[model samples]
Target: MLRESHKDRIQEEIGNDEIVTGKGLNQEISLVRAEDTRWNSHLKTITSLISLFPEVKKVLEYVEDDGDNGASRLQASGLLSYFKTFEFVFYMHLMLTILGLTNSLSQALQRKDQDILEAVDLIRTTKAQLQMLRENGFDQVLEKCYSFCDKHEIVKLDMTEALNPCNSFSQFNKSSLLKLSKMYPRDFDDKERMILEHELDIYYHFVYNDVRFANLNGIADLARSMVATRKHLSYPLVYRLLKLTLVLPVATATVERCFSAMKLVKTNLRNRIGDDFLNAALICDIEKEAHAKVKTEDVIDRFQKMKTRRGQI
Candidate 1:
């Protein structure tokens, strides 16, 4: 609702505007403050594997079998062995690493699949790994908050449930790949599309059936907001929907952090800063922990010496 609302407001505000967009806004910060970390956390698993397991090289050999269908990812139950090697990472990943995984897995419990059980066990073991590493792992842990999704936002079909429908539950064999070639127009051998189709269908069902989609609801809502309320500016209705559902207090933590750093750099002494100068301040602030980091004075000095540099340094 909020995102849809935002979209309307934005569109109204930018009647003829087209600014830079699509994941370019502090891309790293966006990942850090994501509304959903499932995809990123999955990538993080590789890091966890590299970090926690000293025996990662040994484990890689076991995870190296061509799957039943020759797909080469992981065979059914074949993933079990690899699952164990990094089993210790689960709880740590869950409690300490990926909260989105926890939520997704918990919801998967309804299916009663052995894989889900394994996943839960995996998370538990990861927690145990942390426990042994520390006296109380939970202390370092912040219970994963689905604060963004938990409120007004409605959840769509999750991964597994989405793929495995009730109709196809009885049969081991599933649907075909060629059905929606346009959507999955990629050169890939496979029924992967068939699997995806099931999941996507369920996701759409949840969106239309569950969320009561107010964004695409109509022009009346947009007219009311832009012309009547005149609240948020020309943001389109669709963008508004995405932002509202996704943006929780946690989602913009990176942005907030950047703002804090910006405030420190662009203080009264640096208040003569240009937009570009302020942007540089944010960049330097974030890279403080890394090598090749930018210096604060470099920016501060530039601003202090600006043509508008009338302020007392």
Candidate 2:
């Protein structure tokens, strides 16, 4: 095979020396090949994993999947996977990029390959989008840096309180969006324009889901406020925490799976099980995956054999 087999050759290619730059990296990058646990945060780990599928960049490259408004483009499908792969890296770059780090920009600019540079710029654009939380006179400069709307639709908003979800999205309507778009200052920068536009678009979701999120969802409320000001918002701590927790249902499709499992187990043989027993049995039956490492084939097989013998009698 065309490969480096020796420990030395492989280590040489993946060595610490090749890590080159650690611009936004916090942890020390290490080389891990066979069984080293330290590879989790290494440069090789980051790049190799991102490199596994060139398809990621392709998703970002797609400008028009749906024939919708030309102004709105889809975020890269690879970008989400990139998110799963490198949240810390994304945030680190976000911080560096928003702060306008000379080094970070330089690394991106230094890439002679136009394609890579453009991709890096696209990634930077996403990471640098910023939303501010201003309630009345106070400005709580939000740290989750990101942009809002695109150019051409710049707008200004005159708001009172820091808009919460109830006051923001759920309450927003299409007419309000048009009004926000009208408020754009003539000489606004690209980012300002985008933020204002993003806020308006965000308002639509709130208008649709007001009933479901009337007062319960905390993060949703905060996002709704961003809609009020006509800027897309990102709450780093709260959003990440909620995302990880909510992902099981929203992202994983596990809720539908549980219902399916319930139907499967409650079929004719065990249809008479009471509500209490039915719920418990469903839980235990679906959670067999947790004991996957724990072998119990022999116990189950014996139980089945004994049940068959008794039935024979």
Candidate 3:
């Protein structure tokens, strides 16, 4: 009832030219609810909130003054008050910036194509952008926040206030490498495990000093570069580890894709699908690229070869 009222009010506002359309805002725009399962949903919610700020305030004000129940009026009043706070505005801009940076990478990871090299490249780019933002983006964010607060008539923070900076970075250590190696025990022998740390040290220094390895697009490029320069032979353990790292993302995406495929394969109409058939269907659905390559004639030939029929059709 409340949402319908709000929707009607928004339409009225639009008709009165109180809420301007264009620049991604339209009559169809509404408050998007964030889902806990998906990070991108929060992005959508924030974007909608920002775009519909004025209309939202108007709706809230109307509800606060003319709500049917005291509780609804009180809730609307509280939200209006909270919306005007400097902290809320500041965090909204901050999250918008952070999530905007990572949104592409998140989407890329979940793609059906699932390019491992491209995903790795995006991860690197996101990390680099985040590090750069950490070092230099505070003043920019602060300026935007101040601008937004001023535009919305919200109370702004003092520019004279000094803020402490936080900084941290992670490096792969021998212990961490050993732990990772233990997870793939079959991939590493006792000798390889013992010498892995040494290979890593040499590989790190070599790559750091070598211009050829610097600014490589992704792990795939790095692997190819190492092979091109015959450095993979020099650092076999590190190359193995790199190969292992590349496979992990694809494996995770495959599992996610399988679960997604299950919804399409075993719908309400096909709810009686057995486990065996469902599994086979999921495999075919998830690996559509591979499945598409198999010719119908080849399948027919293989099926015919599987059994000797009493009567040939």
Candidate 4:
């Protein structure tokens, strides 16, 4: 509903006299769709919502009062109530903060030249930042939320009151913590430390220290360098492991795109297409650059040569 309202406003602005000629001030932007499996898309959607808050609020107000149906009015009222709160603002900022790092990491991991070594370093950096945020970001977020609420004239929640659990059952007693820890040995202490130490040992001595792996910057480079240097033959097991890692596809945006395309291509009307044909079609769809390089004349010639067919001038 908020996006729909913004769309109307954007269209109005685009049709307006003054702002239409401006480059940056124009209303060409649209809200991104947030897919549940794609965190970056969600981040983008949230970011867009934050940018269009005033317009969104106006739209919500209109819907709350002027909706055609009771259900819509109720839904809009609920959404407006939820949106105009310190908790929602704080959570929005918090998710945007966290997803920024994760989005970068996701993009980096999906790069064609992505290195496992570099990915490990990026993961460690992100983990450290998360730890810092966990320790100190709550108060900072609350302060920002307070300022936002003040600016928007929303009822500001008392921090102390907000911190209290709504129900006694929802609050964990001091004794419950002790009991939970006693019940679960896995939650006891220093397990994470031990795991980190062991992982660091493997990475430092095995993955990073090797001269072959150290020479190249990316996984693709590593593969090529290993082949050129004949290090694969020298360290067969390590090379095989590295090769496996390089070949192993990370189910990131590429896989999501493939599935999205598959849904369109394999609709009920086109269900008769064989798996092999579907695979070929998908390859052509996904690798459009490669597909575009093939000459149509060459394809026709090949088809003609495949069997004796109807006469062609």
Predict model 1's lDDT versus the native.
0.39
Candidate with top TM-score is 3
Q: How many clashes show up per model? A: 27, 17, 0, 0
Whole-model lDDT, candidate 3?
0.73
lDDT of 2 at 190: 55
lDDT of 2 by residue, 35-58 (tens): 221212233444443233233333
Tell me, what's the RMSD of every candidate? Answer: 27.6, 19.5, 15.3, 18.4
Candidate 2 weakest ten by summed lDDT: 133-142
TM-score of each: 0.20, 0.20, 0.45, 0.45
Q: List model 4 lDDT by residue over 1-313, tens digit each.
A: 6666667767776687434555556454556889845677888998888768877788879988999999999999999998976557756876777777578786787689999999999988877766666655656665767777786787655432211222321231323222222322453445533443343334334433455555444445655766887866754533443443333122234676687678878888998999999999899888889999999998988988988978961
- CA lDDT scores, all candidates in order: 0.39, 0.40, 0.73, 0.63
Model 1 earns a TM-score of 0.20
Q: Write the per-residue lDDT of candidate 1 for residues 1-313, one digit (tens) a residue.
A: 3234344444554565543445543121111222232334544554444232323333344445433345444453454453442222323333333333334443444355558567778658655544443443322232221221232132311212212323322211222212222222353225544454564445344434422333433323333433443422432322232222222212222544675577688788878889987786677677767625647777688878776755755
Models sorted by lDDT, best on top: 3, 4, 2, 1
Assess candidate 4 and give its TM-score to the true structure: 0.45
